[model samples]
Target: MTDKTVLTERNGRIATLRLNRPAAMNALTADMLSLLGDELEAIAGDKGISVVVLTGEGRAFTAGVDLKALRDSGQDLTEGNVGDALNGAARWVQQLIERMPQCVIAKVNGFCFTGGVELMLACDIIIAAEEAKFGDTHAMIGLRPTWGMTQRLGRKVGMQRARELSFTARTITGVEAAAYGLAMEAVPLAQLDSRVDELAQAIAKNSPGSIAAYKDLYRKSENAGLDAGLAYEYETKYEIADVRERMAEILKRLGG
Candidate 1:
């Protein structure tokens, strides 16, 4: 249930994954990334698990990659190997989360910076604490994001806003993030967990097959042209064989 840096707890069909290094603000180290990947892989294979809520144990969801570890590694970025390794891990983790059949929700409790923002971009939904702060400080750190930030962030917010945030390395509060369309909602810190649970439970109550299909469909169609997206949706309709039965069930539940 708990690794040194990552803790996983399950309640019914929902699994909560916490970045456990609270003292260091859950700054990610290479070992932590590997452990997180392992945890996600295990959860992905478990059919009984339908939702995952990713959060941090302490004051920050994550302060991004552990700069101390990177500095100590002493790998020259000009040599490309070090940058490649780091970028590769980030990309793999983000893509894995995006592609998993189970829905992933980011419960942003506090600071979410640099690579942490990239992680949030990959989730299906993000519910942030009112006190949470978000930023992309890659520029300030003399680095650029290699994860999907450049692409996904723009899609989440406007291109102009994404440019302002990344270029300026400015931080935004959770309220601002919601206003900018980055998070689904922002709640008081006290209500963050309960709000996330309410949303996750609502999704969990739906048909698992339909949920999985819908998640996949949305991801696939989001990048396509409207006509193309419509065509894809039309084609995917056949993939869900129980639509009529589901509709009937809905009617029955409505006391029809």
Candidate 2:
């Protein structure tokens, strides 16, 4: 685990990234962040890979940032040191996940706390297992969030619920996460990989050109008002060349 804090695998058009520090419950270290950032950078440039699934190697998705690592590095959550310790490389990894050309899914197999939750939220989609725990324990640890937790959490689960979770520092089951809008769905642990694969395969089979366009359009729309988003959608040039071929293939099954 020291040598490989993150592992990568590719199957056709889908890539899977697994956090490899099971003994530490896949805790986040600066080294792990560097490795993950490198992996994501490579994946982002791959036109053949359209989907990525991120999960843990063992029981916990992650117990959040490696506090021991931070302490050993002579950093702590004292006053303003929290953000300083986590910014640079760590922040880059979060941005990489958000801006990647391909869709990223967080497969929460087990305990997900604080920074782990932040990392999980960075993914475009979240499919959690029913037994997994989702918690924002920053308050309990006396450390403020340096990751996008303050911003992204509210967006995912609405501001009020987000406030409650962060304020209370409580944990929730994956089923509750879906109902609260943090996860797309919560399924049995045994079905998590299969379900993710099912969706990943379905998405991978679609036209890559259109997929790229959709990703670009969706990313752009996130910051724009509705009218502006719609205007862009209507006026911008859509250069996908396989629409006719796709339509023809679909129409062949229409009994027309």
TM-score for each of the candidates: 0.92, 0.92
Error of 1 at 201 (Å): 0.7
- Judging by lDDT against the true structure, name the best candidate: 2
- Per residue, candidate 1 scores C-alpha lDDT tens digits across 214-251 of 88888888778889888887887525556788899999
Clash pairs, model 1 backbone: none
- Backbone N/Cα/C clashes per model: 0, 0
Cα lDDT, model 2, residue 239: 74
lDDT at 93, model 2: 86
Off by over 4 Å in 1: 1-3, 78-82, 237-248, 254-256
lDDT, each prediction: 0.87, 0.88
Give one digit per residue, the lDDT tens place, for model 2 in 1-256: 2558899999999999999999999999877888899999999999889999999998999888887887788764576345554666678888898888788989999999998999998888899999999999989988888787888899889999999999999999999999999999999999999999999999899987787677767866876889999988788886777888998989999964
**How accurate locally is residue 57 in candidate 1, as Cα lDDT from 0 to 100?**
93
Q: How many steric clashes does model 2 contain?
A: 0
